[model samples]
Target: MSPNGIISISILALQLWHCAADLCNWTGSGFGADGDSRTVLQVRLRCTEGSVRWVYPGQALRVVLEPNLSYAQRTTVCIKPSRTFRGASVYIERAGELELLMTDGGRPEQVFCFRADGPQRPAIYLQASPQSDVSRPMVGFRYELLGNRSAAPNLGHSGLQTSCRPCNDTELLMAICNSDFVVRGYIKNVSHDPERQSSLVEVSGGRVYWQRSGVFEQEEGTVGASRSVSSWHGHIHTLLQCHVKPGGGEFLFTGSEHFGEAWLGCAPRYKDFLSVYQTARAARRNSCDFPLD
Candidate 1:
């Protein structure tokens, strides 16, 4: 034990023979016959994105992220705790030191990110808290390893300050090309959650050009004169401070999706996007070809 009475458990070097075949997710229980409260379970994941589900968490679990990335590449690790997360305090282990990331019993609605490209790779450590009841809450989180820090969405605290900034022409061009989902839509509604410090923007998409995930779904609705029209509907999350309001005319929504949830990025007026696209196309400067509506 250290002078502070906190036990410093080192990550075990044992082989991970029980790794899941998917190599991106791991699901297991912490209850073992050994009954050693100090036992630390080791899990290794080698994917850009994945998840971990720990049922009946015990002493601790160390998740080592060894994604297939080059040594010279700078990667950022972002983890979104499950909404039902409980009974465990999460930490980031860096160079034998533990830094608390999330406390037990707290609902983590926001995603946490950190740089994990140093010589000593960072790992996630989950330590179970003492329990008095018979409740066996499951604790887990989904993780994503982002290689391009500049292109990645601003999810960290520092990035929150600039979350409301309007995207410039160059940023908008790149956002449309690299974002997970791109669509032409208008804001149907904006709901704010003060507790989570976020706002969900409900969008009625007229056209979906591309999407890396199933974030938007087609919905049939009646227009004027009982005419039925099909439109894509989805929700995009953003910082509450963005002050997003409804009825902003048609916009090109482009953003990334994390853990099955969409986050807002560069959103420009559809007409403005057309002007920019046309100008870029004339100059042969557009990053990718986008079908014009």
Candidate 2:
């Protein structure tokens, strides 16, 4: 289940200064430093529609700066989102792009909590951008990963876990993660004509669901009409539990292409198998544009 709202840490709201016309970077000299001087340490991060993007050589994230500090060796200031999406935090970059870092970490996830602290696991250190801080004899520190600062009570995570790699063919990626909170995924593709070819997202114990082709509107429970969503604002249909269940859940896609669609049926969860229904609703509608982020 998703929370109604989320909170942001003060550091998560760092002051940002403009850099190049096409870019903005964080440059703060704490404690000591001169305009002519520099530091050998820095934290790297970026905001986007999905997870924060770190402009690494390959556009990847994660790296250790060799800092000697124990706790919070350092931290990154986060800029809260201007709005919300799919019941998650919304972040804005200096470029005006939006993003959110949703992770299953401890209730009070410090960016490192995964699976909501349900279990201990490897650290998912995220980096946006790092700078050299010669003023301090330090390498750098690791900041938190994506997600709300205050994890939901049931926010389950076991730290960083892996799944079957999408080696070019990911048609099966959707079917696999449709069963539990543990079975979640990230989107690598977006934009499929906009009018059609919506993206998909599969979660543990949930099927690959999609967006309803409209903006952020509260959907009707199952057995209702086909909901409308904003195309540009992009509604994130959490088929994870919308159409299938009739047990007081919103999200049902009653259209032609889905009349008799069949799939690998599994034992259902939720009193009326809420998860299964939503997954199927998303699967059949062709409206599940969930992989954008």
Candidate 3:
């Protein structure tokens, strides 16, 4: 069911089984979901097998297991909204060990836990109550299980547990040219955004090398919203968490003024191609206008 108390119109079932191609290892094979609304709910798995799948609202599912197999298998799943749309987050109100009645014969399966641990490993959690003023509350589940090492020895990983990805070169260039100012600075403060969907970070002790709108103090820092955690000032220079990429952590950054407010974007490092961005800056300065060169 969705957190808003809307009942799901259908359910989905995913089954794990022993694969003859690989011994002592379980393979995820079966998947079934009801309904046609692919936009309602989304699913993504890490270190496990499954493409991003959309689900119906308030959905339920029955999970079947092989009785003789050992209970050790590594699996992590993230249920959230489709990334193609505007930024949104899932709010889980309840989760943990669950007993399910199998559909094959309506037999009950033993409870298992899929909770993730450690900062590197993100797990879904149930808040006592809903957060205030969040626009993108989704119905999703997150779990991380480290199966018995001897049984499931080959759990490989590909993508990050979180949704953030590095920015491309064109995005970096566009961000540099369109901002009020671009600075290289360290993060001095960290707080939650007003909406509670992301973190607000302030950067200080950096120099603003470029400005388009007007004059600004070199000491004055700017803030950005991010979805990832930022390192403390001086310890690690990182991007201010902001809307362009909801989660903020250590990454190359470029800040621009939007609607008279400071906004930043995750960008590629200018140092990587020092001559390129430097040349672009010089061209802009000479012409007193934005130059593609």
Identify the candidate with maximal TM-score. Answer: 1
Tens digits of per-residue lDDT for model 1 on 225-280? 88998989999988888888887689999887777888888899999999998999
For model 3, give the 10-residue run with minimal summed lDDT. 101-110
Would you estimate the TM-scores of all the predictions? Answer: 0.84, 0.20, 0.27
Kindly indicate the candidate among 2 and 3 with the higher TM-score: 3
Number of the top-ranking candidate, with lDDT as the measure: 1
Evaluated against the true structure, the overall lDDT of model 3 is 0.32
What's the ranking of the predictions by TM-score, best on top?
A: 1, 3, 2
- Evaluated against the true structure, the overall lDDT of model 1 is 0.78
Please give the distance, in angstroms, between residue 3's alpha carbon in candidate 2 and its true position after superposition. 44
**CA RMSD (A), model 3:** 18.5
lDDT of each: 0.78, 0.24, 0.32
Q: How high is the lDDT of residue 202 in model 2?
A: 20
The TM-score of predicted model 1 comes to 0.84
lDDT of 2 by residue, 126-215 (tens): 222223432322112223323321111112222221222221112222322331211112222222222221222222212224322222
Query: Candidate 1, which segments miss by more than 4 Å at Cα?
Result: 1-22, 69-74, 119-121, 149-151, 157-162, 222-228
Candidate 3 at 117: error in angstroms?
48
